[model samples]
Target chain A: MGKKIVLTSGKGGVGKTTVTANLGIALSMLSKKVALVDGDIGLNNLDVVMMVENKIVYDIGDIAEGRCRTKQALIQDDCFPSLFTLPSAKTMDNSRIPPRVFVSIVNELNQDFDYVLIDCPAGIDEGFHRAVAGADEALVVTTPHISAVRDADKVVSLLSTYCMKAVGLVVNRLKGNLVTEGATMDAPDIAKLLRVPLKGAIPEDEEINLSSQISKCKDKSSARLAYLLLASYVDGKDTKVFDCASDYRGFFKKLQRVFR
Target chain B: MLKNNTILRLKRILLSDKVNMPSGLIQLLKKDLLKLFDSYFDIKEESLKIEIDSNADGEYDVSIKGVSERIKSPRFMR
Candidate 1:
């Protein structure tokens, strides 16, 4: 069965949705069937990030309420084969899903894909619980700031109880220069501070701001490579870990090596 | 977005990668984390520019909001 993993953050606006969408697309690019679940419920935003909001016919709410079948609501990408998004309901209905329902939906998705990435909402509320209840693992996304790291630590501690398999960290918006200058926390420092395994680190990108209108990003974009590296890591690939500092240095080195 | 060789490298790793974390499983922490966030946001709502809009897609999309919009916390230093 494909892995059922939830991407969560304790605080809001930490790029959880961006990570989920890119990871799903990148995994599917490897020909692995990937399904993305918007676990935010009432405040569903994954569809917008994936650019499938208008395509959502039957949401998880409909499936939970027995109004529609599971497969009916899936929004498959025409360009990216084997990639699908199970969007959350945009309405204000009670977004609280029972644990059994959440598990059932994830289990059903797991049967058909190589990976199921759940986009968990910020905050440790009922919505967050329902999102994490059905996952085999959890990936907590955060920045290098003190508040973000503090919340991330709690997320790791919280997932220790719910995530059956393991809990990992994806340090997003890492500015290597800032860390080097002591302006922000570094990736390894955040991992050690939270006591969670470091799965991936994403460099901050301006392109991510424009991604909501268009569902895709440039292939060579820093955020794209970071997310692809993350997808590779999640797939158990031994690819070289992403080096944010090398973002500038490595580019020139590769160019020099090519000429040599 | 990975090169063909990079994808192959990933496939080889997947042959043995099982989503293992160094701190795999531990005693559950429950709402202990929630308490920490609540206290941090408790008396700082005024200085903190918190925004939670569901319709900000294609703009703030997944959330151009959260705590990243210039709300530096003072507790980390103290």
Candidate 2:
């Protein structure tokens, strides 16, 4: 069976959906058959990020409700035929969909795809519970602030109850320049604080927001490089994920490095 | 009766920490606790003052009292 990995975060607006989209694209780039499931039921946007929102007719709820077959719901990406997305129900209430239904949907996807990445809704409510229900693995995304880190820590603690086979951290919106200026915590520090292994660290990039709206990120900056490295890791290829802090070298830091 | 260990764990914990309890445990407490709490207290749009004190028997006694007066401050919720 393919690995069912849920991408989730406790805090909202931490780019959980964006990370899911980029990872889906990166994994597809490596010639892996990937399926992106939008687990955010009421506020589903993974299709929009994947640029398949226009093609969605039968949503996940329809499949679970037995109104449509899984094949009818799967929207194939034109850019990457290997990448498929199962859109979430836009009008359905999150509490209405049972965990067993979501699990069964993912199990079916696992038979065909190499990777099933579930984009979870923000906050640890019924939506969060439903998202991780079918997953053997999870990546908790968080920013490098105290509130976000605290929320991520709570998520890591809650993942124990679901009993995932593997769990890791993805620090998003990491500003290396701010870390160098002692304004924000570095990815490693945040990972250590959360007590989860760092799977990925994506830097703050306007390109990410811009590209996902237009298309998935194609530029070779810190954000894209980090995601590609993450994809390589997920592909079981031995690769080091990029450190966002390495890009920043201020005048004082340069002088300090010179002195050292 | 709530154990001392349970109270100790509850101390200084955030809402996210306490809210994610097992469904079985929540169901076990909800029905009994909700009915019991409803008899004595009603939720009002005001801050509550709670006090906990240890008696001579070394058991914690918890009390809850609603604030009668409302604050007309701009930062009432904050």
Candidate 3:
């Protein structure tokens, strides 16, 4: 059976959905069959991030309520045929799918894919528990900001009670310039503070933001490379993360930073 | 300096009761403690205090203290 992992953040807008979509594609590119599940039932957006919003005929709610089969709810990706997405219902009603049902759905997906990535909703409420109930491992995503870090810490503390196989941290939107200037904590420091293993550090990139909002693809970027490394790390490979502060040091680089 | 200050502030915030335990949970704990203490002595509900302090190892130290008016009449062995 495949491993089921949940991508979660205690605070919103930390790139959980974006990481889920891109990392799913990245893992698929690595010749792994990956399935992305939009666990944010009320505020579903993973379908949009994967650019498969128009193709979702049945959602997770249908599968949970026995309205349709699991295969009917899954949308196969066009670019990466090995990747599939199970989008959440667009309406807000937490009672439709209990935590145990969500667990069963993900367990069913585990039989087929190599990795099942669940894009969890923001905050530590019912939605968070529902998403986490099915996962064998968890990836807590947070930005470098103090608020986000603190929230991630609380989440780590809570996850300890669940006895998950593994819980790692992904520092998203890390500002390389700020880290270089000593204005903020970097990925390692943030991970250390939270007392969780660092899975990946995704730098703040405009290309990532643009690709998440629009259905446009871009060439190789720092965030994409970081996600590739993260995928490998999740696949049980010891990979060295690419440096995010490489472009903010030295004389010529300082000039380039000032220009951009 | 900003990074250090943020780390320090975050440490303080994490130790706060708002993050460690919600107000509702604290209230329930207080109620349960009051009931347990009432069986032994007269507990002052208004004076009952629940404190969560941080130890050197960054672990929580919960203290529940109260001033009892008097001990309840002993009838356990009767």
Best by lDDT, which number? Answer: 3
Task: Please give the CA lDDT of all the candidate structures.
Answer: 0.72, 0.78, 0.84
In angstroms, the error of model 3 at A32 is 1.0
Model 1 misplaced regions, further than 4 Å: A212-215, A248-260, B1-78
Ranking the candidates on TM-score from highest down gives 3, 2, 1
TM-scores for all candidates: the values are 0.72, 0.73, 0.80
Write down the RMSD of candidate 2 (Cα, Å).
12.8
Off by over 4 Å in 2: A213-218, A250-260, B1-78
By DockQ, is 1 or 3 better?
Answer: 3
List the candidate 3 regions with Cα displacement exceeding 4 Å: A213-218, A252-260, B17-78
Ranking by lDDT: 3, 2, 1
TM match of model 2 to true structure = 0.73
Instruction: Indicate which candidate wins on TM-score.
Output: 3
RMSD of each: 16.4, 12.8, 10.7
RMSD, candidate 1, Å? 16.4
* Residue B22 shift from truth in candidate 1, angstroms: 30
Tens-digit per-residue lDDT, A175-233, candidate 3: 88888888988888888777788989888888878776212444456677887888889
Tell me, by DockQ, which candidate is best.
3
- Which DockQ-derived CAPRI band holds candidate 1? incorrect
